[model samples]
Target chain A: MATPQLKQTPLNAAHRRMGARMVDFGGWDMPVQYPYGTIEEHLRTRTHAGLFDVSHMGEIDVRGRDAIAFVNRVTSNDASKLVDGQAQYSALTTPEGTVVDDLLVYRFAEDHLLLVVNASTTPKDWEWIRSHKQDEAVELKNMSAEYCQLALQGPDALRILQTLTDLPLSEIKYYHFREGAVDGVPSIVSRTGYTGEDGFEVYAAAERAEQLWDRILEAGRFGETDGVMPCGLAARNTLRLESAMALYGNDIDETTTLLEANLGWICKLGKGVFIGREALARQKEEGVKRRLVGFEVTERGIARDHQDVLVNGERVGQVTSGSPAPYLKKNIGLAYVPVEFAGAGQEIQIDVRGRAVGAQIVPTPFYKREKKQSAGSHQPSAKTQ
Target chain B: MANVPEDLHYSKDHEWLRVEGDVAVIGITDYAQNSLGDVVYVELPKPGEKFEAHESFGSVESVKAVSEIFTPVSGEVVEVNESLSDEPEKVNEDPYGAGWMIRMRMNNPGEVDSLLSSVEYEEFTSAETE
Candidate 1:
């Protein structure tokens, strides 16, 4: 069989021009890092600002009279609570209460909503959401190709972005968005980001991706002082990992339920009958057997994904996501362990490439944005893990 | 183009070997470090450890992934670069110089004749990247 061609995002040429190292990410020709490297990009996002091309992520528009009803029926979150211009992180749930794909539900109104899903799971999510459609007035349109999304993230992201558009950015609170023009390019400016920073995500037409990208970078460079670094998928992953955000395939999958993934906050199990309510509600009442827990390596080695979690040399669970957090200055990771070993301050062992290394379960949000900035940055952020 | 020093001998696995009298210095090639990206941690074999030709000696961890470094010739490790534990980025910055991983007393000095020359390794790397 012939190998399928890798799909390129609209900003592919710009990435190449910037000397980005490209890799095959889920069959998409995506930049993994720039010449400066992932560690530098990761630190740049934490300290200053970083621009990310997230055009590969899929977007599906749900329209019709039953849009609200259809969305609430198919997803795990309470869409009825989302007002106009409000967005919530949610997931397309399976009948078995597992996640088909974790997504962001942007409610334009009661009759129109846009679901942004993981790039690799876009096709699968579409088929799954469609399979659940049994005589509803809902119309699902896959609009993945027509749009390009960029996330401007960091502590100074707002100051840089404010120069681009007259969107009244500060008025757009956390998790709120507005439709406006960014540097004359039409966009949906949402104050939502994967990195746990005060940032914004812009969704614009695919044809204008390059224009919007260059303008944002320019705005970040406003005076050629606060330049926004172009980051890649590697930095994107590390930033999200530090935030303790659940990655689609790694942190949560078809076999992992919302409650088990520590995403019970998004699970409005009481909101009528949904796709996964039955199984999820049952699990809630019975209590979860295993849970997703954040941890730090107490010893020397770094614990990575798929490595075993051991207790007295006996295998228990596995690490779902792990990395050396450049900002936190320590090795951190997430894993699914038995409930007995999931609490904060609990001790566990990580099989780091066959070496049973010591680890400590810790509270999440490994790096939290400080409410106030001091004179110096000795320990400006709150690190729970 | 990757910097393949004319005097160094290379293995197909991208390790470059520099001989000094009976002692042989070994490290990854420029192409290898460039592909690895942002070295964070390096695991090196201790002095006195022995290995055969084309054997795995140590591992290098970058920000995103881990890769193994192979030894080009058989020998006992005479010295290992200890500075790498604190500063592995040297592997990416100076893979052929300060980044040299280990020094070995050669088991068979004649093995150098079978290794790829600088020009041959350059061609091999160009084809591999393509």
Candidate 2:
């Protein structure tokens, strides 16, 4: 039998032209890094701006008189608080309280919202949302292919992005967005990103992706932000992992809950009737079985994802994400363990390929960007979580 | 287009060996380092440890993944690269020189004849990558 070809985004050709080392990421042929390397790209995103082709991420539009209601019903976060032009990081959960997918809710208007989900979970998310509609008048449309997303992330994101649009980007607070024309193309510029740094995500028409990608790269070429690194998914993964942000299939899955993943801040238990609200609320009352914790390897080996975590020579949990953080200059990872071993400074061991390596639980967001004037909304500005 | 030096003996697992008398110096090929991407740490066996051919004697770790380093021929480790403890990037910069991983005394000198030559290794790499 022949293997099926991987899906390609609109920027596929552009990535190849730039000499990217491509990989298959969740069935999508995406660039994992360029010849410049993942470390360079990761650092550049923290110092200067890094342009990313996030077109493979899926987008679904929820429109109707009950759009906000429908979204609030399906997502764990209280979407009713989202005003026009605002966005929120939320998760769609199963009735059993495990995550279907973590997503971004963009409130376009009173009757319309855009849900940005992970690339691999798009089809599942769409079906879950439609099935939960339950006679609601919401119209759901999968717009994953209609728009291409380009993320310009770094401390200089605004300085570079301001040159392209006349819109007052400074006024748009974090988690806020504005519909404007970017390089003569209609676009939705959102002040959000997976990386911990301050950045903007541009959603543009699919046809204009190539030109817009080039134009954004060109615009970011000035003074301090010149030669913006064209980062790939590898850099993005490291960036997010350093921030202690959860990745869907890895950190939080169908078997995990918001409380277990340390995302209780987004679980609004009192938000009233939702798919997983009861289970989540009950779990909250009884306390979680285990809690996710960030750790640093005090030993020689690098702990990798799925490695077992041990406490007192007993297996407690497993690593969800792990890597040698480029900027921190240390090996770090996230793992789920019994609550007793989840505190900072707690001692633990990671079984790296059968060899026990000493590690210690530590406070996360190992790398935090100094905040600029505009503070992000939707969640408490706790630099790490 | 990874470098496969003409004088080195290559293993199917991407290790290169430079034999001198009965002692052989082993290092991962340029192709291996390039594929691994920015090796952050290397776990090497002790100098006295003995291993058979194709046995995992050490491990190489990068920011993305971890790979085991297998010995190309059966031998007793005589010396291990200690500089890599602080300068792991040497594996990426000069994989054939400062990045050489281990030195071992070959238990069976005749085993060298079984390893691939530079030309054969180059062809193998091309075919594997394709």
Tell me the native contact fraction for each prediction.
0.73, 0.67
Clashing pairs in 1: none
> DockQ values for all predictions?
0.84, 0.78
lDDT of 1 at A296: 94
List candidate 1 segments past 4 Å from native. A222-226, A372-385
Off by over 4 Å in 2: A222-226, A378-385
Give the per-residue Cα lDDT of candidate 1 at A120.
94
Model 2 residue A169 CA deviation in Å:
1.4
Interface RMSD, candidates in the order listed: 0.7, 0.9
* Model 1 steric clash total: 0
Among all windows of ten consecutive residues in candidate 2 chain A, which has the lowest summed lDDT?
A: A376-385
lDDT of 1 by residue, A1-385 (tens): 9878999999999999999999999889999999888988888888889999999999999999899899999998899999999888888898899999988899998899999999999999999888888888989999999999999999888888999899998788777799999999989999888887778999999999999999888878822434688899999988888888888899899999988898888889889999989999999999989998899999977889999998778898999999988889788999998998888998889998777999999998787777443312112111232
Model number with the top DockQ? 1
